[model samples]
Target: MNFEYSFEKISCKDVENFEKIRNVTLPYDYKQFLLLNNGGKPIKRRFQSKDGKITSSLMMYFPISESVEISLDEKYKIYSIGKIVPSNFLPIGIDPADSLICLSVSGNDIGKVYFCDMDYFEEDNELKKEFISLISNSFTEFTGSLYIPE
Candidate 1:
């Protein structure tokens, strides 16, 4: 695993403010992580792709502000709720191929992380419905899945 962290840890106040502005409650496990370190690259970066055939690694994990920024920026173009990705799914990280790793914030799947294929969604309109795939049940589980490759 090769962890490359870049931001300082955020304070509880920052988290609270972020929550208020975003209007979404972050999962407990991920909230704890944000307090420890705002955002960066994870060490055990690889995960199963949405197709279940290939593997992928996280490109970057957005800080709270960055997450909000990207979510809003891409909302209409790529991640609009009930369009490409789900409404409550906020992008947390990206893959080498620019696919998104999202956290479900509002729906029944809240707290679960997902691997989303943006390319597939953009390329095939009919496939948009199947763009997202589950990665882990929680942030802790996602971190625990990281491993150093030989």
Candidate 2:
């Protein structure tokens, strides 16, 4: 079962909902802390849907969580800018059915296995190229060196 994943557009309004989920799921305050430290910049380069709703958001921040080294057994590889950073301020989301129920996860290192309720994205080569073109300054090939189970 090979599943493909693509990025999606996220808006400022989506940030508010994401914040609510983060506050509840995370042990410590992630939203406020991220704002103070990294100015809370959202990764809007890659997007799937164009409904002005962010189906997913990948944020970059200073390494705060314990760093996990990539090894032979590692499954995912996340190549961040500059250095190998661990972001404790992770991506959180509000369950569409139950807004009260918030699901959050942190420390999604490279070669990590994730089993969750994320809507699988179909890969569009053209769209991906467009996104890469848009963010020429921050483009890094996801070298398929690691076997990421689809």
Q: In terms of lDDT, which candidate is strongest?
A: 1
Write out the backbone clash pairs for model 2.
7-47, 7-48, 8-47, 8-48, 75-111, 76-110, 76-111
Residue 27 deviation, candidate 1, in Å? 0.6
- Per-residue lDDT of model 1, residues 1-150, tens digit only: 245764656689988886776687889888888778666777777777434665678877877554455433344235533455676787777888988888887778889888877777654343354666888888788878866566
lDDT score, residue 42, model 1? 73
Model 2 spans with C-alpha error above 4 angstroms: 1-16, 20-24, 39-150
Candidate 2 lDDT by residue in tens digits, 1-150: 111321233343444554363332332343333333322223231222223233322222221222223210111122111112122212221123211101123433322211122232123311121221111111122112112223
The C-alpha RMSD in Å for every predicted model, in order, reads: 3.6, 17.4
Regions of candidate 1 where Cα sits further than 4 Å from its true position:
49-51, 65-84, 123-127
Give per-residue lDDT, candidate 2, residue 60.
26
Instruction: Give the RMSD in angstroms, all C-alphas superposed, for model 2.
Output: 17.4
Native-referenced Cα lDDT, model 2? 0.24
